[model samples]
Target chain A: MLGKVNHIAIAVPDLVQATAAYRDTLGARVSQSQALPEHGVTVVFVELPNTKVELLEPLGADSPIAAFLAKNPDGGMHHICYEVEDILDARDQLKAAGARVLGNGEPKIGAHGKPVLFLHPKDFFGTLIELEQL
Target chain B: MLGKVNHIAIAVPDLVQATAAYRDTLGARVSQSQALPEHGVTVVFVELPNTKVELLEPLGADSPIAAFLAKNPDGGMHHICYEVEDILDARDQLKAAGARVLGNGEPKIGAHGKPVLFLHPKDFFGTLIELEQL
Candidate 1:
C-alpha cells in the first residue's frame, strides 16, 4: 500500500533563491538539481535522512508550476510522493477503491529513473499525489 | 536541519473506510489511530519505509478538516510532516526566510511524544506544513 516517503515537493518561483533560503536558514543542502524540460520545471532536492524536500521552479510560462503559481503565487506544496513496493499493484488497488488514475495507463521512468504514477488531484481532494517504486 | 519525514497526511472524511481502502488495496496496514481533541480530528497512520500516510477525519463541526473537506470533500492531501533536528531552530529558520509561523510560539507534545510545530498556510501557498522531531 505504502512504502516510504520519497519526497515532498515545494513549488517555488526560483529554485536558486529557495535553495539558498533553505541552506542559509536551516543548514539543509541541496543534494541534486536538475531541469526536467518535459515537466517544464527545474527541481532541486534537499536530501534528509529518510526523505527529501524538492524545490520546483517553473522553467516556462506553460509549465504546470507557472500556472499553479499564477493562481497561488506564494508557492505551496505540489505533491506528496510515496515510495511503494509495487506501483502497478498500488495503482490498481486505488482504481478499485474508486480513485482516479492520472498515469499514462502504465508506469513510466520518472526523475532518478524510478517508476512512477500520478493520481488525479480531483480524486484525492485538491492535492496531487505521486506514487514511486524504489 | 532536517532529519526525516515523520508522515505525509491525507485528509479524508471517513477514516475507517479510507483505512480499509488502503489496507485492501495496498496491503498497507494502519500502525496507529487516535483522536486529537484539540485538533478536532482523528488520525490514522499507515506506516511505510521512510514515511507514512496519515488519514485525517474531522471530529466536530468546528474541526479544521471539516472545513477543508467542505471545500474539497473527495479528500486529497493535508500536510507534509518533516522530521527536524530541532523544532525551534527549524521554525526560526523558516521565519527568517519570511515564512509565517503558526505554532503557539513553542513546540508541544504531539502524537507519540514528539515535539511538533506548524507553519502558517498563507505563507505556504495553501498547504499546511507540520514539523516534528523525534
Candidate 2:
C-alpha cells in the first residue's frame, strides 16, 4: 500500500534561513515559499533527484506545527509521506490492522492538492506517516 | 552536490515490533535485520520505490542511537541520508559553508559500505544529515 516516498516534512522556525541552507549551502533546487492557510503552514520544496524535502513554518497562531516547533525550537522532521494508490482502501486496511488515523479518519486535501491522511505516530514506531493518494 | 535521497533513518526501541509494523501492518517489503556492530546499530530496510527507510535499533550498550532512544523512548526520525558523487568534495564544501561535520571530520564506512559523514543537526535546522558517497 505504500509506494514511493512523497516527501519528508521538516518543520523549521525560519523558512528563509532553511530555504537558503538547502539552496545555497546544500546546493539543491528549492521552490518559493508558499503559504497554505488551510494547512496552517508555509512550505518550501527542496527538490532532490528522487524525492522532495519540505520545509514547513507555522503560518497562523493555531498552526498544526506550532506545538511541534514549540517543543523542538530548532525545528525537526515532522512527518514522512508515502504515495498510495487508493487512500480510502489504505486507511481501511490500516484501521482494520489496529492503526490509528488522525483527524476523524477522513482524508483531507493536502498541500499538493491530493487526498491525504495522517496515521498516528504511536502505531508506527513513533513515526508520523502521511499517506497521499497518487 | 546532493543527489538522490539515500534513505531516511528511524531509530526504533524495538526492532522486531517495528519490523512487524512495517511489514505486516504497512504492507511494505522489509529486509532481514542486519547487525552492524561497528556502527553500533542493527538495521532493517523498508524498500520503497524511489528510496529506502532504514529502521535502526541500538546494537550494544555503546550504540550511537542509545542516547537518542533514551530521549525518545518511542523512537523517532534519526537522520536523512543523501547520496553524493564525491564525499570529500561534499565535506569540504559543506565545511567551507560553515556547516560542522560530526566526529573528526573524516568519512567513515557507513552500514551500506559507503563512505559517509554526518553533519551537526544544529546547523541544519535540527535535522541530522548524512552524506553518503554514491
Candidate 3:
C-alpha cells in the first residue's frame, strides 16, 4: 500500500526560522521555497541522503497551515507522505479496508507534480497520511 | 547535523492492532516486538525498502506514549528520528544554536542499539526530534 516515505511535512509559523534551522543550523541542503497557491502554502524541501523533509508555511489566511499554526503556534509535524507505485490501486485497497480518502476521494497533483491523495487523520490513527504516486 | 531519517515513531494505544494494520492490511514486513523498559515503551519496526516505521505502545503507566494516547485517543505520530554522523557534534551544534536537548542532554542507547538523544519539542516547533549517531 505504501512504498517509501517521500517526505515528512512540517508546518511552521515562520518559514524563515524553519528554513534557517534546517539549512544553516542543521546544514541540510535546502531547495528554494516554492509557493503552491493551490495548496495555499509555501514549501521548501530539505534534501537528505535517503529522503526529503518538507517545510510548509501558510500562504494566505485560508491556508490550512494557518489553522494548524493557530493551534500549535510554535509549529509542528503536520503530515507524512508515502510513495506508492500506483496511487489508484493504493486508494482502492485502503478504502476497501475502511480507510477514508480525503477530498472527494480523488487524487490531485501535488508539489512534485505527482498524483497524491490524503487519508483522514482518524483513519490513520491521528496521523494525516498522504499517498503519492511515484 | 542529521544524516537520514532513522524511523518515524507512532504511538499506538494497542500495538497488536497497529501491527495488524501495517503488516496484514498494508502488507509490510514487520519485526518481532521488543520492550524497552528504559523508555517505558514496547515497539515493533515495520521495515520498508527506504526506511522503517516504529510502532510504539506504552509499557507502563508512566510511559510517555500513555499520555500521548490519552490526549490523542486514537494514537498519532509521536516523534521522528534522524541519523547523525556524530552525536556529540550534532548535540554541540544544536545546543549552540539554542536548541534544547531533552533528558540531561546526554545520549542513550536506543532501540536500534545506537546512541540517541532527543531534542525538545518546543525548540523544534512542537515536534520531538531524535538524533541517532550513525
Tens-digit lDDT string for candidate 1 (B51-99): 7778888887678677778876778677877778778778787777787
| Candidate numbers, best DockQ first, in rank order | 2, 3, 1
lDDT of 2 at A102: 95
Question: What DockQ do you compute for every candidate structure?
Answer: 0.53, 0.92, 0.73
Instruction: Indicate the residue-level lDDT of B134 in model 1.
Output: 72
Model 1 global lDDT (CA atoms, 0 to 1): 0.76
Q: Docking category for candidate 1? A: medium
Better of 1 and 2 by TM-score: 2
Candidate ordering by TM-score (highest first): 2, 3, 1
Question: Which tens-of-lDDT digit does each residue in B1-134 have in candidate 3?
Answer: 67888899999888898888887666678999999988899999988878888999999768877878888899888998999989999999988988888889989998778899999888767788899987
* Chain A TM-score, structure 1: 0.90
Off by over 4 Å in 1: A89-98, B89-99, B122-127
Residue B31 accuracy (lDDT) in model 1: 57
Point out where model 3 deviates above 4 Å.
none
- Superior by lDDT: candidate 2 or candidate 3: 2
- C-alpha positional error of residue A30 in candidate 2 after TM-score superposition, expressed in Å: 0.4
Number of the top candidate by lDDT? 2
**Model 3 interface DockQ:** 0.73
Best by TM-score: 2
lDDT of 3 by residue, A64-132 (tens): 778778888998889989888998888888888887889899899988899999988876678888889
